[model samples]
Target: MEKLKPKLFSVMKNYSKEQFLKDVIAGVIVAIIALPLSIALAIASGVNPERGLYTAIIAGFIISFFGGSRVQIGGPTAAFVIIIYGIVAEFGIDGLIIATIMAGIMMVLLGLFRLGSLIKYIPYTITTGFTAGIAVGIFTGQIKDFMGIEMGAMPAEFVGKISAYSAHISSFNMTTLLIGILALTIMILWPKVNKTIPGSLIAIIATTLIVKFAALNVNTIGSMYGTLSAQFPTFAFPKTNFQMISKLIAPAFTIAILASIESLLSCVVSDGMIGSKHRSNIELVAQGLGNIFSGLFGGIPATGAIARTAANVKNGGRTPIAGMVHALTLLLILLLCMPLAALIPMPALAAILIVVAYNMSGWRECLSLVKKSPKSDLIVFFTTFLMTVFFDLVIAIEAGMVLAALLFMKRMAEVTNVEGWKYIDEDEEDSNDSDSISLKKVPKNTLVYEINGPMFFGAADKFMEIVSDISKDVVIIRMRSVPAMDVSALHSLWNVLRICQKHHIVLIFAHVNEHPMAMLQRSKFDVEVGLENFCPTIDAALERAATIKPYKK
Candidate 1:
């Protein structure tokens, strides 16, 4: 069994001063990159700017300290913006907190059971589709601040938001639009000038200074969310009841699934960069604990931020110490520099999120898949994407998974076949093979049935149909091509056994594969059928059939 140990412990055994210095440099650089983006993500999530800092500080520290990946920077990420906004809008902040805590508990259970690898079963099409949809959601949500549109609180639904934006098209402020454009331009152009300093940070600083000195008439974080909190996060338990838990269950599960996917994906990406392996279950447990603490401290839901994690790696971070230092840096900023964060223009923050959305959209990948992937995959991708954009994200995920499963079952069923062997062709290349059914002579009043492919619920009904036609004095079932069995398929065989008993016919099984044989043994189907009736080959089964006397009805 694999041990549940954090990567930090292993890395610490070989820690050195030179590596510590590099980690510190990388950690501080990542913190600088996370600062403005965290604030932007929180505001986009319809929360105060400080909550982002709180999450980045509290959750970030916990995840790194206990995480399986050396440089996974966990905090408020763009992926959760749509879901978090929806939860906050419908269930209130308390509901969001409760849901996050519930999600945390669920994550811990998933890790403890060592089921983290199960997340890979979620189809890539679905993840790509929803990620693109989330990018769109983030872009749409920022339009109000990005263009300074005069509207009451933004609507939660995509259609409602579109309708409201259209209604308020005439109220967009020119000054705010120009500031947003300026910030966007800076974010786009600054990276070429200085790669070491993030373009988003530079854009924020430039736009905030411009807005402040020029006394521009535009919406700013300070104007909207009021003074930024300069205090450390304080913890408090949320008041909850059964009614709230029941109401929030679906969203909580959604949060857990999303967090698991994003964090593990980030881990996989970072592992490639660092040439290291990550313990997925350990990472999940750390993420759960991080979210639990973040929520208690009045922070929004958080997961691994891919961009920040990448930034850490590119900056020479090679251990968990860097991630921990990154969190501490954010804490120091939260305590001293938070007040300055309020002066940042809303348009600048929107500009930052716009860039984030574009990076995460994966448009090129989506287009390539559309051109080359199978029709079923394309259908799943489009369905998930459209549903996410127009309906609820939870609905999109549920519908996508269900659709994918049904399509998969259909394909499996199509491949599974059951047939009776009439006569083997003498001209066939392998007809003379020793194990060939052609060499065996069937006894009078005997029938041979061959089942091909896996025996699963999807293909069980066809096998049952073959069972219903069993009227021979002696029956032989050939399952050499079968590799596995499900309960439904096993139950169908039981029906065949019952029919043979009622008709007073001799029953035998030939070439029972390992998986099916084990299932038969476990179900005690083998005992009821008699061990002597089970044959290893067609020759043996034919001989056994010939020796057995047919029972009189």
Candidate 2:
């Protein structure tokens, strides 16, 4: 389909040798930066380290090869850590794969239906709330490794996790704590030292060497999860039934929604940086294919990683070739150096996730919203945040959306108003000298009621109450300001038309906007009220009213 055309094709048409070289260099640098992040995210997601690498190599390649954005690098990101962990914890790795595949299918359908732009309708407050909540969860989950606390399996719930950590406070390993703090310190300070090199990678290398040479008793990846697979990922299908499918549908939708939002948001950010527009539907399709392949290859869900995409852009990666090269570089590392990943210290990985949690929290934005946004918006924000922290993300999003819809309806109702035009005597005003003035006097036995704002269901009741109170031989409804109307509003108008007809009164409409006019015509309200009753202006309606004979009592 034309909608599925990848940006890579257009970029390659004008590709240059200099740009190619720059892309190659940037891609390699991004791959290096992504290496430690992928492994760390996988561990945080409660999966084997190799799964993350497989996602980077497989999904990363597929996305870049077919994605709409020029320099968006796709891979495992911090956003999915909470959802993936929950899936894996409840249903095991197989459930996670199946859910990811289902989410991929959903995404494909969304793209095919051209619903990419609709993702923007999701409220900013909800995203901010859930994102901050997830950050808190990730940070809390890392406490065990960060402090080297000796504890059994941590509880999945937020409060339970905190209680578990507190119970194990006496078992903290000072050596592990020192390593974590040191890794976190390096990450914070490394940007100032060299902007090009990633501090996470540096921390991994430095800490791993220190533990290996000194023979420290600290836990490493190998000690915890065993050595990672060096071979390429193989296709593996998951077994499922109707019951499992039904149970996974909600989580799958959650994943699909989240992937759509994150990838599109990344594309928007990339567009601003490169001064280019990205095809959102095409990107959604690419993300779907990427996740599908990633799941098939025993990997986790993947999307456009914002930080990595920014890295590509900042390093002069202006084409999809850079993203492709990034995937290839990661693939090479997976095939050649995956075994060495086992030597990476757990605390170092934990520290990296802590930094990730901190950056992803968006605390400044959250605080700003709390202080400046409207009370209704703050209610949605806090409700989503608390629900996400206490319950599941699915519940949090569902509740947030419902609350937002209700608040939106209330606000719309406040904006929509209906009032009858008051008769002003021509003699009371300093006489109008304008000969071009239309409708010199109000027509006798005629009432003009002005309807303002959109006539949706929320304001339909008020509209009906106002119009029902008008008693005249002819009623002219002025709707120039009404841009649109829903079915409820149309039904209310139909009721008014019937009441007017019952009383032998003529009903007319004046200056209706395009959308409302179309709706009225579609519903055949114009025919029921007589086509002649629809006027182009208030003056025209007044002229029509004067022609109509008075009703006989």
Judged by lDDT, which candidate is best?
Answer: 1
The list of candidate 1 runs beyond 4 A from truth reads 429-434, 439-441, 468-471, 550-553
The local distance difference test score of each candidate is 0.91, 0.90
lDDT of 1 by residue, 375-453 (tens): 9999999999999899878999999999999999989999999988655555653645676667667776788888899
How does residue 139 of candidate 1 score in lDDT?
92
Candidate 2 Cα errors over 4 Å, as ranges: 1-3, 427-440, 468-470
